[model samples]
Every structure is written in structure tokens, then in C-alpha cells.
Target: MTTFKKSFLILMLPLMAFTAAHKFYLSVTHVGYSEKDDALQITTRLFIDDMEKLLDERYGLKAQLGTDVESKSADEYLEKYFRTKLLFEIDGQPAEYQFLGKKYDTDMLICYFEIPKIGMDKIKSIQIQNEILTDLFDEQQNVVHFKIKEKKKSFVLIKSDTKGMLNL
Candidate 1:
């Protein structure tokens, strides 16, 4: 109950609160070309809580992703959001991908996409633009991994630089 002790406690309370409130925002995406299927497969992993917040904030809907009471239009909004935020270009031509579906993995939401009929011989380079969760989180980072045959490349994309190119 001393004055010095009370002052120190007050000063430390804000610092403790700030430290506890800090969180890291990150997402991981994998893009691989399948020789057998002659297609490009993409998978993105995002934190379920972060994505739920984004769905609510961006679309004014309580998506409640991964929960029993999830919104019915969640998938539609997810596809719409991702279609605008994430993009790809193969050999300098815009590549359109089909949003296959999404699944929940523990604390993450994994989304599946595919660009069919993409032959290995036709791909000289690939450009990726991933802006997932960047608008909602200023410190968001999107880590992308590309695997084409035996070659592999990785990039860490942020709000400022959301695009990367990999050349074979």
C-alpha cells in the first residue's frame, strides 16, 4: 500500500496489457504443379479466428467459421473475397483457378483451389498475388511456397509488397 509500490503497479499494468494483447498475424499458402494431373493445385492456411473476424468486418456477417452455427453464405463470401485478393499469372497470362472448397484444421482454415489443364511444359514462370488478411491486419504476412517439379521457391508477402514471381 506504499505510494511507490502503487505507482509501479500502475505503470506495469499498461505494459502487461499491451504485451498480452499483441499477436502475430500470418498465413501460409502452397502452390504446386502436379505432373500426373497436369494442373496447378493451391492450398492456403489461415487462422480461423482471424478469418472469422475478416468475414464479419468485410462483409457484415457473423461467419462463425468452423462452428456448428456457421453462416450459410460463408463459402460464397470467402470465394468472392479470395478471388479479388488472391491472383495468379502463368507465363504472363492471367490464370483462373476454381475454388474447390475449404476445411478446418485445428485452429486454421485451409482452402483448396486448382487451375486445371496447366501442362508442365507451358509454365515458364508464375506470378502470385496474395493479400489475404492484410486489409484487416496491418502486420499480416502471407508466406507462399511454390513447387514446380523439382524446383522450389518461397516468398513472404506483406501489405506493402503482396506479389512475387518465380521463374523456372
Candidate 2:
């Protein structure tokens, strides 16, 4: 009994430490379909603490948001990095990106975006899996909606359609 207890505690120590060091917020990814055009679009939002860090780590890149020699300073690296690093893909092709905007509210950052249209036939299926904020809000199997706007020339995030998906 003592030997088993010791082994269990030792195994849990590293996991507990990792959990303590990381703090995650909730987010959602909306994927919508249109039968008329046979198109699909995906919009994802992450309420992560360090978005810059997450983007850098996940994409394996260090992007500069803009190029303004006169305005570019060491402190402005994050802005530059984000401007260029924000990207998405559809059917394995790089989707066109336009910065819709960003707003800071209460402890969360809401980023809006506009992406080029994608054909739905290429998409296999929609999957919502959480790799970061598994502890805070995990829907496991949820429906995410990506709405199409004909006049807008872009897709809007509709909200989580199903579970493991956090709405907003």
C-alpha cells in the first residue's frame, strides 16, 4: 500500500505542476456550410492569456505585423508579429486574411477576421477538439457555426453550434 501510494504521488507531481503554471480561457471555433455554393468557412477565437505566445508556438513562426521603419520599434514587435502571423487554411490551402479588428474586454481579447471563400466539397468534416483550454470549458463534441455574408464578402463567426465548444 505504501509503495503504491508513493508511486502515484510521484506521477501526479509533474502533472500538477504543469497544470498550475498554465492558465487558459475559453474560446470557440465556428464552421458553417452552404449547400447553394457548396462552400465551407471556419472562424476560430481563442481567449488565451498569451495569444502572441500561443500563435508563435503553434505556427512555429515569428511574424511581423507591419513594416514601418519610422514607426517600427522594439516595443512594437508584438503588433507587427500579430499582423503577419494571423492566418488560416481551408482544404489545405492558405486562406486570404483581412483584419476585421480586435477589442479588449474584461480579461479577454476578441479578434475579428474576414477570410476568402472556400468550397465545401473539399472539407471532410467539422471537428472541435481542445488542446489548450481542456480544463476550463470542454464541450468534447459541439457544433460550430460559420455564417456566410454575401454582401460582406466574408464569413462571420456565428457561435458554438454544439458541445466542448464555448459560445463567445
For candidate 2, lDDT tens digit of each residue in 1-168?
699999999999988987775443445555555566454444545543455445456554443322233223422443344445333454444556444555556544555544444554455323233233232244322223445342122222222432222122
For model 2, the superposed segments whose C-alpha errors exceed 4 Å read: 1-22, 32-44, 52-86, 117-168
Which candidate has the highest TM-score of all? 1
Which digits, one per residue and each the tens of the lDDT, describe model 1 over residues 1-168? Answer: 999999999999988886776688999999998888899999999999999999889899899899999999999999999999999999999999999999998999999999999877967899999999999999999999998879899999999999999898
lDDT of each: 0.94, 0.43
lDDT, candidate 1, equals: 0.94
Per-prediction TM-score, please?
A: 0.93, 0.35
Error of 1 at 145 (Å): 0.4
Off by over 4 Å in 1: 1-4
lDDT of candidate 1 at residue 101, scale 0 to 100: 96
